[model samples]
Structures are given as C-alpha cells and as structure tokens.
Target: VNEILDLLYTNLETYPSVRTWVFQKVETVYTLDVRQISGPQFGLCFNASHLHSEKIHEFLYTKLSSKLERDTLALWNLLISLLAPDPSTVTGVRLTKYRKGKRKDNTGTDAVVDYEMDNENLEDGGKILDHEAEIDEMAVHDLGLITVVCQYLCHIASIMAHSTNMRCNALQTAIGFFLEASNAPKTVCELLAHSGMSVSAATTSRMLGPLRSQCEMKLKGLG
Candidate 1:
C-alpha cells in the first residue's frame, strides 16, 4: 500500500484527469444498477461498476487523510495556479538579499538612486493586481469540494449504521429486484437470494430483528 501510494504521489500530475474519470464512473454506478442486464455478465460493465468503486475508495482513502488535508491541498494548488506570480520579480528579490550592504529601503544623509530606473519601470507598467480573484475562486472551489466529500462520507456512515439506510436504498432495491426476477418458492428464495444467505423462515425473521431494534433505538435516541 505504501509503494502504491508513493507511486501515485510520484505521478500526482495525472490526478486531475484520473479524479475526473473516477468521479464519473462512481456517479454512473451509484445512479444506475449494474444488475439491470444480469446473466452472469462479466466485462467492462462489471469492472466499471465494482472494480472502479474499489479503486475510488482506495484513491480517496489514500489521497485524503483528513477532511482538512484534502480541502487544503486542492484549494492551495488551484490558488497557486490562479495567482500566477512573476518568476523574475521573485528571483530579483532573492538576488538583492544576497548582495551585502544593499539593504532594502536604505536611507542616509547622502542617498543614491541606485535602482531608481527599475522602480520607475515597474510603476509605469500600471498597478500590480493582488490575488483577491484567485482567493475568491479558491474559496468557492474548496466549499464545493468539501461539501461533496462530506456528503458522501455521511452517506456511507448512514448506510453502515443500517444497510437499509443506503442513499440509493440498495438493500430494499436488491430485495425488490430478486422478487421481480423469480416467483417459484417466492418468499423464501427471494429473501435468501437478496440477503445472500441460506436459512429457514425463522432465521430470516430473526436476522432482521437486531437491525430493526437498532433502528428503533437510534430513532429514540435522536428524539
């Protein structure tokens, strides 16, 4: 995992494009069911739906250690590009510092206009724009990204608390899909198929008891 993360960071320049593809794939899968045309099909559709989901989880976990880190890094890079500072000016500042007795803003009774022309040239070029626009743009982007990541994380937590609470209601959806798939030995087979478990009616009934109790307890606590 460390090696994989290192490799990803080493090639982090490709992250934007990779993130775009991953986001699109995740959205498509979450919105549409891969089980629609089921007959043990295994191809791009399967890989795109399942394998891509796994990859997305891995990438998100690896890239975003905490909410702060993810939001900060993305915003920082966007802001940096938007600001677009002049390299020459930065280099000139460093060079000036390196030259001894060339103190910035030097003052004396006998003064000299050593860099007068340089200052005049810049002044004539017009006012240098501050990065207010870049800061605003970054604020908007950061807010949007943070909102998206938080919403998804909350959704996952909700689903984990109660499988039935999945944002897309996957458990209920699976049950409905299975029932619609077949009718023979209807209830038993359908429940077993949907739940991914083989058991008698009594066991099936008991299986949901704990979950139901948990939901009721959570609701009561909220109240």
Candidate 2:
C-alpha cells in the first residue's frame, strides 16, 4: 500500500500537466503557493483554494474521464458524489437574527389592581417586545466534499511519504509512542510495525529516551 501510494504521489508530481491541473483545481478553493523543499521526492508545495468542491470535482471528472483507470475513476466519482454537500444545507458560519416569542400572562399598567377599580382588564401578557431579533453566530454549511477529499489525500500522502522512512514518519511515530505508553508487548509492537501501522518498537524506545531526558531536565530545573 505504501509503495503504491508513494508511486502515485511521485507520478502526480512528475507529470507537469497533472501538476498544473491540480494547481488550477485547488486554486478555486484555497490560495495556491509553491514552496521548494530539499526532500528526495517532493520538490514543490502548493496551497489549497477557495473554489466550490462541486465544480472542482466536476472539472476533475471531466478532465480525467478518459485518463484514469475505469475502476479508479469510478471510485473517485462515487466518493465525490457520495460526499457532495447538499445545496439546501448551510456551508459555513454566519450571523443570523431571530425573535424571542412573547409570553402570555402579565397585566398591563392600565389593568385593575387590587386597590384600584377599572372597567376592563388590560393584558400585558408578560410580553417583552423588541423590534430587533437576537443575532447569533452559527455554522450554516456542511463540510465540503472537496475539502474532505483534499485533507484525506494530504494525510495519505504524508503517510506514504514517510512509509519507508520510519524515523521521520510522524503519524506512525506517534502511534508507536502510544503503543509504548500502553506497554504493548514486543510481539504486538512488531506486528504493527511490520504492518506499517507504526514505527518499530526499537525506534519508539530510542525516541522515548531523549524525550525522557528532556522531561527529567525540565523537572530538575523546577527544583
């Protein structure tokens, strides 16, 4: 899986046309920028955009209709369609105004008090009338399909990028640390490591040692 994903990412980067298409697509929703890195695989980084996910996905489908493998394209299309946001649903946070309903019980000043005599009972109904509705901030939009796709792709990319390099695999390294904290047995640790779910137990222990030293130093400093 790691090798497959890594190959896919490398292919994505190597193809100038694909890179340009991706850049154009993402630029619709997020501000795009390219950054150079010294990494062996990745050379440039770009930002996401502000364009609507629906349009972006549509454009993607149109462009890759004949290019991607039928199964892959079908899966992509299915995922996009399934995750697409409903037009009726709200998309983001916005301030909205609403009125509080009036209550029905209190008497007005003109109503007859026990000490005063009045012909008719004037009702106030405990109504507090305000001309303006209360304003509230709330989320109006559902999560964008494109946003989810981009984030999912990014995480997958991160995992694949570090798959072979456990020393720099932050996600797996964190998982390894969690396993260590739980005192998982060597067999279990090795199983997960071999499965590419985390760094090896040895690497976890090596990392923990430095972290432990730093923690001890901090504690001594307080003393």
Candidate 3:
C-alpha cells in the first residue's frame, strides 16, 4: 500500500495519466453520499463517519504529510488548474497576467498601474499597489486554499478518531477547545462534531480536564 502510494505521489505531476486517474478517484470520493446535517445558521457541515472507510488519511500520510501543509501554494495551483483546466474557467482567475499597483503621476497624484507579466514572472517596473483589486483577489485565493486544506485535515482527523480513537487531531481538537472556552452549547458542539469540525462535547470535556487541573494547580501556587 505504501509503495503504491509513494509511486502515485512521485508521479502525480510527472505523468498525465497518473494525474487524471488520481483526480478522478478523488472526485469520486468527494462526491460520495454523506449525511448532510443542516442547522439554522449557515456553516460548514459534513459527516466524518461517511469518510471513515475511505483511505484519504492513508493517502494524506503517505503522499502529502511531508509537504502539503508547508507548501500550500503548490497545492493551491494544482487544485486551481485541475478544477479549472481552461484559462477562462472560474478558478483560473487566480492566474493573473498583470500585477496591479500604483504610481505617482507628474502632478504627484497616485495612478493605478498594471504591471503585466512578460512571461509568467513579475518584473519590477513600477511601485506595487497594496490595496484594492489585487489584494482582494489574493485574499480570496488565500481563503479558498485555507478552506480546502482545513476541511481535508478535519476529515482525516475525524476519521482517525473514529477508527483508532486517535488524539492526533490537533485541528479538530483545537476547534473543540475553542468551543469549550467560548462556553458554546452542547448542541453546538454536537452540530460541529457531525461536520468533523470538532469533537463532541463529552470528548472536549475529557480533553480539557487535564488542562483545567493544571490551571487550578498554578492558581493555588500563586495564591
């Protein structure tokens, strides 16, 4: 299994056939029928149990653990290109030909400047603009990448928790702890738990117990 995963990972970008097959498999898994739980408020909701049987965690550990989190730009680009193969596609907007900026005119008034890329690389010809369109586009791309990464991580964490009672779910655990700190309702915790965004309220209490005890010990010493 590890050998197969390694081969696929190594050849993911090197070979077109491998890339197509891998992406198709990924799409199939993503489209699997999972219980969609909705609440009054609009938020991310997904059933982790549906993905528990899937080998997403195995793929993640074997293929992506080394670099996925560190080099998200590459993942962002890959995802964008895969989802939007054509430059005119919706996701392809991230591939901008020009870097927008600002320059001072003869009258000292700031004018918008578009630094067109000569060959997919930005050249220093004008002062880079820090506001408006460019920043907004960048912000959108960053958020999209973050959302994708976090959701996948959450799925892996939740699956591990279900299959092996694993406590290595730092992302889900953090969300659970945050909910605990916020004194969020048990119903709220349960809702997020179904979505794999957090552990259940009971699990959160168990996880927080040691921390609470340590805090109490420190308070006593200070007192």
Best by lDDT: 3
- Candidate 3, residues 1-223, lDDT tens digits: the string is 9787668668747567777777998655443311111221211222333222122223333243333334333433444455443533422333332322224434366555554445333223222325477668668876776567555643553344333333334346557767988999889989988766677877766656666676677899999
Q: Between prediction 1 and prediction 3, which has the larger lDDT?
A: 3
What's the lDDT of the predicted structure labeled candidate 1? 0.40
Candidate 3 Cα lDDT to native = 0.49
lDDT of 1 by residue, 129-152 (tens): 234653465467557665665544
Worst 10 residues of 2 by lDDT: 91-100
In model 3, the Cα lDDT at residue 56 comes to 24
Q: Write the per-residue lDDT of candidate 2 for residues 1-223, one digit (tens) a residue.
A: 8786456557856667656766687654222111111132331111122222232224332232222223234333444555555632321111111111111124323333222212221122112112222221221222343445544433343344455343335445656777988999889999978766677887766666656676677899999
Q: Clash totals for all models, in order?
A: 0, 13, 2
Work out the TM-score per prediction.
0.20, 0.35, 0.39
List the candidate numbers ranked by TM-score, top first: 3, 2, 1
Residue 13 CA displacement from its true place in model 2, Å: 28
Q: Per lDDT, what order, best first?
A: 3, 2, 1
Q: Is candidate 1 or candidate 2 better by TM-score?
A: 2
